[model samples]
Target: MTDTASLGLEDRTARVIAGQRVWDELTPLLASRSCTLLAAIAYVGSHGGELIKLERGSSVIVDASVSAVRAGSTDPSVLAEWIGAGVGVYSLEGLHAKMILAESAGGSRPAFLIIGSANLSGSSAARLTESVILTDSRDCLDEARSELLAWKIRAGKPLTLEEVRALGEHYGADRSPGRKRSEQDDTHDAATPSEELPGSTPEASSASRQRPTQLLLVRLGEEFDPPSEVIYHRDRLSSELGCDDADSDSVLFVFRDQSEPEWRLPLSQGAYVIGVDASASGRVTKQTEVAPPGPVVYLYDDDDGGRYCYLHLTESSRDVTWADVTAAFESLGEKPEFDRNYFRKSAVDALLSLWPEY
Candidate 1:
């Protein structure tokens, strides 16, 4: 993201969270300089500029451009916006980078600061692309300033006082100790629509569809090695499961045959929905789940059949029950929502028809 390291400047004096993940190494470095700014985030959709506390920071710049997307090309711009939320996490542009942070400092070369290759989504990667990271630079700082300004004006995405106030309003009004974001508050409406894309209600899209069959396998990539605690806690059904971290791939993987891969389910097996829900807290929970909801699915529905549907658990760690889950499914059945329709984009019918029943 331009010069990614610039976000960590000013001893936390001024911090900006522009859709990217702020890092540790850049922490001490940016704090050293009085330069202030939040980090930038990347994904498959749009770059929404900045998301900061607005307590004591300014001079925020970001490279959230959508021009990166085009036929047969690597577009970083199209992948700059999905970092703040979890809607399209594994899509090519969505999974491009794990929150790229451009330093608050100016003049870092952006061409030298990216992290991955192959258009982010793990797919038909004819090439092995390589991206870099720039902790500090003046050139990058300039580009970021330009980028954010453009998105704010053209795309209408800007980190402003009004938006911050809105976030505060939503989070503050519910500070009633026991109050939670997920707690039923009819007065507080859920922004996500009841239903959005194809086959959204588990009724099967009226037209049989074909979707990019990308399987999230369990193998770890170059990015990270999860901590012991993190692993122990999530090991519930992750051991023998593939696609556990499919989203982890900088690039999304695709297959013509659903059964070709040893671990993935076939096209006619189960329905997949990308829904937005909140817990007791105010967080947009997006996922690709099996059985819609309400059913507490097991790790391996069929051992010999090699069929299994997984509900992606990005943040929630609590054990999910069938009753509540079914209700969720019921809720999902009510409606669907998202900037992009994953099912429609990639024909999901083939996969659903093959889902094995318990």
Candidate 2:
């Protein structure tokens, strides 16, 4: 027998399912048939364990943020089960949308789509007050599938087995009292009376070793004589360059050099811009933009050298780091020596000239 529809009593095409009823309705649907499941949840917990019971074809995509897998929120055991079941597990950075699409063979119910404020967690599905739209509309399911496929395409890379294992280890370690205390001490650098003596702490001795460094947004010039570099202090630009604030976690480095032969500049020096997130945190987070299937862009020397390629920042540009850019190029099987030299005056001019084009 078909399950009794619970919430969203008002809408004809969609129903609002709330609280524990959300799981009540979902669990039966998942178990009744062999289906394909696609989920994008911002946060997950042991309650997500329900997914493990799904048939072999099911897939799940989760946000890779640390907070998503925080000790109390996500159950590592559940994740491990999903991985061991040969389920397709992926991580999409900056993913906050919570959705589930289930497609089944010919039956009374062939497709189902759930989208709502609740994440895949016990509190979210059963305890906390939450709302989700339950729909069987073909249009809604089709659109969701298309959007999800697009997100998967832009993810560039999936969370590997090693990454998942590391999450489990970290979750386990963070729960230990000793590990928590060590972490607290490392961040605070202060000791209690019962702890180490006043002047004997390791942090006290290492205070002199901290070095001052600044984040810079650089632009390489047309001549490529001096690689462009911007230097600033405390997230503020000290230079006369009229470029926007460089304090953001990610900064764009525009390369406007004359195109060179693929052989001369194995990395293919051309007019393209790349963004680097200098902030130490969230370096692996992918951008929302639909990035091209391959590297950011490829450059080939135009015979005249006058043909310039201008890159305007788009919603789809990936949030990467200097390290990521270097690594991506390296993966191309070409090791091009990157110019690390910082030139102040030339860097300013290059930005100024390119600012108008952007």
Candidate 3:
């Protein structure tokens, strides 16, 4: 019951590739009408400038805003080509009944059409629901495109929070289709609310925002699997949870070899990294009405003897509660105390807990 696809189409940027088990018949199409086809498999975005990503395999539970990667058979090259496309390239690698690709992927940025389902896990996915376009008629592809490039140029790699926001200023809202323009969301001006900004607000800034004791990261394998698998994508995801600061904001750097980013840095210095899974989730689900509700983070040990933590978070704003937090902590078998008042310090402790496994 796996699905995938490769596409070959005329130059126009209007078409749909939606179906089950579609990967087998897919193909990659290069640039056309002055556009380059682009694609990749990664959940990327910024929250107050800290780069937060639910990279692969991990399932993040959040309201659809930024994107929920589509499903299908994915080829690395095709995925890469999708990113190179002229306008906006949204690679819906997994998270729905069908895999999808849309937009010119060149000359403009594209807004995502995320969806929801009955179950977020790969195993329960087959029993999940149908495709639901979370945000159609984005009308911001043009703005997002410019901002995307500025973000790429600033980071010199994949998009980061600062870079993502840098584009926001230029590409804030709706982008007229077929006409590339700048979005004003991420832009800075004398009029922007200063209190909630990353630099001014401790709670709002990625640099100051406190997080839970642990974080989670997930990567979709060839396709979303009823059963997920572990993967080691080192080299691309910097060994040190690669991160940098731009425009005074912090974010995780991206890898050129891979179109996706390598890490999701904490919004604040106090955030921590923790790994979650079905086995672990079961314990937490028992304790609360709302689950952790997003991609699960985990501690990963590459064969090379490096240890780093991952996060399963969204690009746009995300909200959680004390009940969910308490449930996550209660699930640990004999966890240690976190160093700080917030979860930031606990995330480090959580990652250390996995030291032996690596």
Error of 1 at 43 (Å): 12
Q: For model 2, how big is the CA root-mean-square deviation?
A: 16.1
Off by over 4 Å in 1: 1-25, 32-38, 41-155, 169-291, 294-358
Task: Give one digit per residue, the lDDT tens place, for model 3 in 129-200.
Answer: 223222223453444344434433433333223332333332222211232222211122111122222334
How many clashing residue pairs are found in candidate 3?
83
Better of 1 and 3 by lDDT: 1
Model 2, residue pairs in steric clash: 8-16, 289-316
TM-score of 2: 0.46
Worst 10 residues of 2 by lDDT: 206-215
Which number leads on lDDT?
Answer: 2
Candidate 3's C-alpha runs over 4 A off are 1-15, 23-35, 38-40, 43-141, 157-264, 267-358
lDDT score, residue 45, model 2? 63
Compared with the true structure, what per-residue lDDT tens digits does model 1 show for residues 222-334? 23244444344235434322224565311112111123333232221122232223332323323323222111112232333332333332222233333343343353453
Q: lDDT rank, highest first?
A: 2, 1, 3
TM-score of each: 0.26, 0.46, 0.23
- How would you encode candidate 2's per-residue C-alpha lDDT over 234-334 as one tens digit per residue? 11221211124354222223333343422122121111223233223322223312211111112222445522222223222333334444444355554
Lowest summed lDDT across 10 adjacent residues in model 1 is found at 185-194
